[model samples]
Target: MLLLGLAACGGPPAAIIGVDGVSTRAVDVPGTHLLPIYVATSRAASDNPHLLFSGERSDDVSYARLVVSVPPDRPVGEVTRASTLPPDPRRHFVVVAAQVFGSEADFVSSLNRDLMERPAPRRHVLLFVHGFNTDFPSAVTRTAQFAYDSGYPGIPLLFSWPSRGRTIDYVYDMNSALQSRDSLLATADALKESKAVAVDILAHSMGNLLVVESMRQMALLGRFATADRIGSIMLAAPDIDIDLFRKQLAPLPVGDPPIFVMTSANDRALALSRSIAGGVSRAGNTDPEKLAELGVNAVDVTRVTQGDRLQHSTFAQAPEVVQLIGRYLGNDGNLAEDNDDNPIEGVRNVLFEVTLLPARIVGGGRVVVVNE
Candidate 1:
């Protein structure tokens, strides 16, 4: 596939920006006018600014370090959908910047300067694993978009695999992601083994499967102790076979925090996915007996409304789902508020809240709790 990227630029350049009480380095990238704010961080300005958590920016060939520090006085949600961010005195929910480091050598050379120069005790590091039919540039832009939208105050990293941005490439893209799972592990392991900052995962669609499989792989092997770095995992409309997932992922190895799986029966996209694959995808369909057995806390999304498709991508489409993701990531985990008026199966509920009844979770009521 022809990749849309930036032409080769020289050595990395550095600039200074102040948000809150700290000063952070502004690393340059391909398109400057696209995103208003580049990065915000907790690393002290006195520290080295070259070293930073890096990523390939939007298939553009340029790489960057994403940091956000929300201003203490401002509400982050405002800057989310706005065209121009980094407004004066708005309390930096995020400060961001990137640099063009052509090779792994250049990326490493600028690492220390980037990390040490920002405010210490950084907020969060969100690694977004985008689903099918997306390009690297699309992934990076969306990562910034969600970070801005969700008002997340942390460095947003995009773990992009080569995807052909077309539905026909589904099989190829799926294989590509699976094949690159080890590379993802290696990258994440580097972070897990580093002193950079806190880490979390927000994976959508097929990306969710890859994220889970990667973590599960790392956890099972006792490899990177950093797998525990995952504060929370947001699986949005994951397209995986329920039966296969159970057979493969049940009894996952113990890690630091619990993993959250969000699904919806109203996801029309998943319906298409079902038609294409001819099996029950894990998003809305799973064995009721296996919730706890798989060590996952599932949430039914049919009651929620998200995007244009009213589709499988509910995690990003709906405001409530986004809020729930924030709550989950923020450690504001409250089971009671997990529903309010909505009764579920297990906190462990099996009901998938589908618009139609499929005799499973679709026939809503309380999901039958199993071995729990």
Candidate 2:
């Protein structure tokens, strides 16, 4: 119903790289920002040159390096794309450069080379896993937008699974995510073994399921020995069942790369998912206190009103929320405590105030109360 309608709004245009006699080298625009996004995908190659990748699954993981140009003068949280072909770099989010690696060794070598060029503190890596109904171009653009908005100096990487990018293909997308778990783990391992100082993770919606499941596997395999190299693990609007999420976290040791979950009770997409899952509660709509009891930091954004019509993307679409995340990352996986120099200090103050109050159920949704 509502979820289906929201999904029908469509995604970004097909990525035009090395097509229409366009150069596959970096395109420089005076006011625009260029972001390099390293990619590890489990999707098969597409015949269409504009797409480069398709929704079909591949037996082995593929690697690529893409440079995206972010339009200047746009809103903080928006990633605008050109509606027509031969994208305008000055005004639209377009791929300015692309390189497909023929071997895993080549990709690692290139990534490490880039890491060495950055200052020691900026040698970290940020890996983003997109949720259901996402395509290759959309994921690439989203990663660039997040890196640019957050002012993150670290390398940005994308682990894209074979999502059909259709709202009606929920079951297929879920299976695809599960199918790509091994590939995600391999990608993470590559990052951990690279010359980078640390690897931070950000996952949205159903992507949380993939992340958690892969982490559980990592724990079982005793891969947390080098967990010191892992930074924040932020889950935004997870669509997993509450009980399943608990089981997944049970195996992990305490404080292994400190986990943060962003929840919003008003998320209509999760509400619909809950109904589809036989009324099982989705983790994204759970109370913060309940999540805290599970040894994870939970930030509730139900009070924030900025996002798309469905309210599922508030973590990225809300200016205040995105700024808060950017500040958290900039602070090296920890949010500053009462810093006046922080631009989003007012939002942080409000969040702290609400967190102290007890939450109560209101008309089947959770809401915080004030001591009157």
Question: What are the per-model numbers of colliding residue pairs?
Answer: 45, 0
Deviation in Å, model 1, residue 224 alpha carbon: 5.4
Q: Kindly list the per-residue Cα lDDT of model 1 for residues 1-372, writing each as its tens digit.
A: 122111111211222222222233222222121233222211112232432322211222223454443333222122222123322223323334445345444543444344555464444566788887764334544565456445454455677666655666778777866766776775664455444456767888888777777766865786635445556666666777777666545445432355556666666666767777876566544433344346566665555554535456566644444545654554423322343332221111112232322212321112322110
Best by TM-score: 2
How high is the CA lDDT of each candidate model? 0.49, 0.77
Q: Under the 3 Å rule for N, CA and C atoms, how many clashes does model 1 have?
A: 45
- Predicted candidate 2 versus true structure: per-residue lDDT over 97-161, tens digit per residue: 78999988889999999999987777878889999888888888888887777666688899999
Cα deviation at 125, candidate 2, in Å, is: 0.3
Name the regions of candidate 2 deviating beyond 4 angstroms.
10-12, 18-28, 226-228, 337-372
TM-score of each model, in listed order: 0.62, 0.88
